[model samples]
Target chain A: MKMTKIVRTTADVFYPFCLVFGLYVVIHGHLTPGGGFQGGAVMATGAALLIVAHAYEDITGRIRKTAMKILEAIGLLTFLFAGLSGILFHRPFMANWMAQTGKLFGNTVAHGPNPGDLNTAGLLPLLNVGVGIEVLGGLTVILLYMLSGIKEEKKP
Target chain B: MTPFLLLQALILLGLIVTGALIIAFKDLLAAAIAFAAFSLLLSIEFYILQAPDVAIAEAGIGAGLTTAIFLIAIRGTKRFEEKE
Candidate 1:
């Protein structure tokens, strides 16, 4: 049976906040406890919440499998690009080329614990974003597949 | 005992109860919900163990996503467990 209106409403309300928080975790991954995998899972959790609250046929319109595949591909490509960018810069295969460059996310860090800077951490933030998107797409795809495989029931 | 330890013990107890509930529920939906509860407790345990990253992942995947999948599957099949 379809979930009650209250459950659907609650899921709708919480979904945006979940997405935002997941993005925050991904963006601040370099300085925070969570990284790409964790943040992506969190984001996928939001999508799963919506799916659980609605019927399968209703959700297909909201979440397209093609779009999810594209998203997954993009994320993987971004990760590869980030890793290979080091070679493009004439550095090692996976060197920290952006570190200590005093550029975007390139500030150097001193020894020991100190006030963390978002502008530091070099390629880590970018890699985190890549992995985060990848994970979100992967997990959401699994949920969608499972949901779609089931026989659809009439809406209440 | 320290309050922190006491709280930890309570969480542990809750975990045991939820775990048992997951297996004992005749309704598959209820079992899935109990599994979600178990996942939540496991996440808390991970956090207490100083693995916040794992905790978040566990909460998201285990409690949230896994439960949703299970519910969807149950909706497709049957709510009650099939007796042999």
Candidate 2:
């Protein structure tokens, strides 16, 4: 069963906010309190909001299960590659080799506390993005699977 | 007692109350909602304890995703508990 129009409308309005906020959390994970898992769960919460507001058939068209599966795979690959990159650089696995090297996400910072820089944490932000998307895809796919189970139960 | 301590106490009391409510409710939906409230209070407690990371995780997973999952499960099953 679908929710009321008001509920759907509210979910639509808040969906982008959730997505953006979750992205912010993921991107700023190194400098902020939340990290990949938390941010991804927040984004998944948005997906859940949308899924709960609409019917299964209606939602499947917008958020295909195959797409979610692909997303999950991509995220895992990204994370694995990011970790494996340290081996290529002759460092330990998942090393922060890029830090203080004056490259992308490698800027140096002062010792004391102050406004944080986005380019300060090397490898961490990349790992965060990887994990964030992985959790999002995984959680959303679980919900979709549950919903599909409900649909199947009603059939026969 | 300090105001911070008072606030913490109040939140802890709320946590216990909500925890009990989750068990006491006959309607599974109501129990799920109470669980959400319990999660929220626990997140707040985490924040006040100087662990914002745990707080954020708790709020997102415990308060948000878990509640949605529970609601979906209830939708698939019965809303009210069956008598033994």
Candidate 3:
């Protein structure tokens, strides 16, 4: 069954703002108070809003399980690749190899209580992105599975 | 009492009320919505406690996602708790 008009409108109006905020939290993990897990869950909330507003059948086509699986795989693989890259470069696994290296995300942070710099986190941002994608995919996949399973339970 | 502390106390009270409502309501949908409200209050409490990361996570997973999941489950099963 479809939701009331107000619910649909609320979902539409809130989704874009939630998406942007989630991405901001993910990207600014090192510079801000939120990290990959938190931001990813935030983004997942937007997906949930839409799912709740629409019937399972109307949404299953768009929020495909296969696509979420692929996204989850890519996110985890990217995180592992990052960690192993440290080993390949003769550093310990998951080491901050790029910190203060004058490269991407390599700016030196001040010693104490300074405002955060987005460009100074050194591989953390990448890791955050990876985790964010993974969490979002994982949560959505779970939701899709539940919705799909319950579809059959509906009384004829 | 300081204004901030007063505000915090009110929020805490709201949280308690909502938490009770979650259990007290026989309608599963109302309970789910109450749970969402409880989560939202908890998120605010986290924020007040200087844990914005936790606050955002709670707001998202607890308030938003969990409520939706509960509603979906309710749709699958039944909206009202059956009298035993």
Each prediction's number of clashing residue pairs:
0, 0, 0
Consecutive 10-residue window with the lowest summed lDDT within model 1 chain B = B63-72
> For every model in order, what is the iRMS?
1.2, 0.9, 1.1
Model 3 residue B72 lDDT? 75
* Backbone clashes (count) for model 3: 0
Q: Model 3: how far is A122 from its true place, Å? A: 0.7
Q: Please write out the lDDT profile of model 1 over residues A71-133, one tens digit for every residue.
A: 989999988889999998999766778988999888889889987889998889989999999
lDDT of each: 0.87, 0.92, 0.87
Q: How much of the true A–B contact set does each candidate keep?
A: 0.90, 0.77, 0.74
Q: Single out the weakest 10-residue window by summed lDDT for candidate 3 chain A.
A: A147-156
Q: Please, what are the lDDT tens digits per residue for candidate 3 over residues B1-84?
A: 998899899999999999899999999999998998899899999999899988988877897678878977898888998898
**Angstrom error at residue A65, model 1:** 0.7
Q: Candidate 2 clashing pairs?
A: none
Tell me the lDDT of model 1 at A10.
Answer: 96
Error of 1 at B28 (Å): 2.3
For candidate 1, the docking band is medium
User: Looking at candidate 2, what is the lDDT of residue A132?
Assistant: 97
Candidate 1: Cα lDDT at B66: 82
